[model samples]
Target: MEEQFYLVWPPVLLLLLSLGRRRRTLVLGLSTVVVAASAASWLSYRTPSGGSTPDVYFSPVLGVVPLATGCVLALLLDDERCRSFASGLAGHLGTWAGAAAVVGVQFWIGDDWTDHAWTFGLLMPATGLAAAVLIGGLVSVRTPVSVALSWSPVAWFGRRVSYSAYLWHPLVIALLGTFAIGWFGNVWLFAAAVIVSIGAAYAIEVPVEKLRARVREARRLVAEDHAARSAAAS
Candidate 1:
């Protein structure tokens, strides 16, 4: 069956825009959007192209619920007095709890990601919570893990090869499958794809980053000079 992602995106966008508005209005708007999203997802699932499963039908609803709720929580609970508590809750307990929930749910559902167990159930909310925690932690950390991870072999090479490999790996996979190379097993197929992706990133992407960095630095320097000149004139 052909996949179309627009089914999931529109309602999420509406919910995001409704954040920070009046509670009554926001709640009404979000409720409407959620129902619409759920219905659309379900209809898409029931359509002849796809099989009927509650998970597939309700995937978009699952993702938007946490986002809408969090926005509401942030708006309604915007309290200076609770800052410390919110920080602590977000950092230590929230991040790990959400991650564990995802791992647990995956195990329970037998690791079926596409059929909707991963998309609609615990995975989406867990992802949102994990993102919130990671962002919070990164903001607070004196020396961020990004710095460490950036230099790690996995990250460095992964970032470098991610682009060309991402673009070309699909074609490579299609070719391999067409040629009956998949007889080796799915693991080998995946491994071969990864190796190809990394090779492409290493060979094509690292050099492009150098040019991109230089351009960015030049722009920064120009902006700094303009600021200095304005200060001098003032």
Candidate 2:
């Protein structure tokens, strides 16, 4: 059934495109049909049948295709009032709904959510689109300073060596556990990993970034000098 739909979708989409008067409705309806078909393919999947393997195409198909389709429809409308209304409506629903679902699921699952890496990967692009729209709407009137203030903590943590901590902390905890340490509970292990991560960040990663920046600047200066000498000769 999935294979049949997958094969047929292209022809159906082309048929929809041929309909001039109902293009927007047909495009949107076809997009929804595709989303539902794709989602059904996901939900009914069986691990034994190679369904559990991570699908990298999920986000591009589910998130990006719909967005592109909507934008195409807006452009086809070509009227300011219609475009504005459509954009606003679509932006509100997509951004708010996607962000809310991701946040809600994260809260519900907590640390365990990372175990289902494939599911999270599928949702992330949609979540990103939502975040982009939400941030765009908020920043339209605000200063960059205000936007930076709003985003600083999240930005800092995302750029930090938190991933290094996440990657290595399990090994550290396992080693500690091997020693039969009763005191190394989740809280203690987590705190210890954080301390080690911070130390590593300051001692190693910061220095590496500084060295890379220095090298880049040195190359830029050398290039500038060469350019200046060539210009002088000319």
Candidate 3:
């Protein structure tokens, strides 16, 4: 959750900088430079006795590099050639293989690898690129993989609850911990967290969205009525 707080400012800054024409190029170049600088800074000060201080993965300031890199990759995907390349790569390797490769590399490296500067500086961007390619590839083409992802039940539910899930999952996990419910295993905990988060999100967000829609509808009717009166007078 602290990571989520740290993540907020970088994307906002990227969004602000992304305005206007030539945005893709501008953002890509800017993000590249920022990522390079972050890596360089890590390399300069990193010691053999690795520790978490000045970590790029979690540092409020340095964390921007990964977010910015994501922005850059997303922007690149907007280009037809880049999207085609991604789609082709996924198509050639097969979707499952591509996905497995990405997951396997991350698992192989392990989480603590980031404690060392060399691995963090090198693998972070590399893994980000791999993930972007797989995701971009999946959505860009009309394969079984893409079709499954676009299936209404899966897509709509995810769109509606994903943010809520992200916000509420930590609380649900903490509550479970407090109750000492996690002694069973992580699988049960994860299942419980997901169920609770989705339920909570729908309970809150659905009503709020309905209210917002009603407000907009009211505003629209008022404007229409005012326009009709002006036209009558004229």
Q: Candidate 2, residue 23: CA error in Å?
A: 17
Alpha-carbon RMSD, each predicted model: 7.5, 9.9, 5.2
**What TM-score does candidate 1 get on C-alpha atoms?**
0.48
Question: Over the stretch 103-177, how does candidate 1's per-residue lDDT look in tens digits?
Answer: 565566542444653354444554555555444443333233535545678575555655666677777778775
Q: Candidate 2: global Cα-lDDT?
A: 0.55
* Candidate with best TM-score: 3
The TM-score obtained by model 2 is: 0.45
Off by over 4 Å in 2: 1-96, 110-151, 162-184
Ranking by lDDT: 3, 1, 2
- Provide the lDDT at 210 for model 3: 92
Ranking by TM-score: 3, 1, 2
How far off is model 1, as Cα RMSD? 7.5
- lDDT of the candidates, in the order given: 0.55, 0.55, 0.67
lDDT of 2 by residue, 171-217 (tens): 67666645544544756777777777777787888999899999999
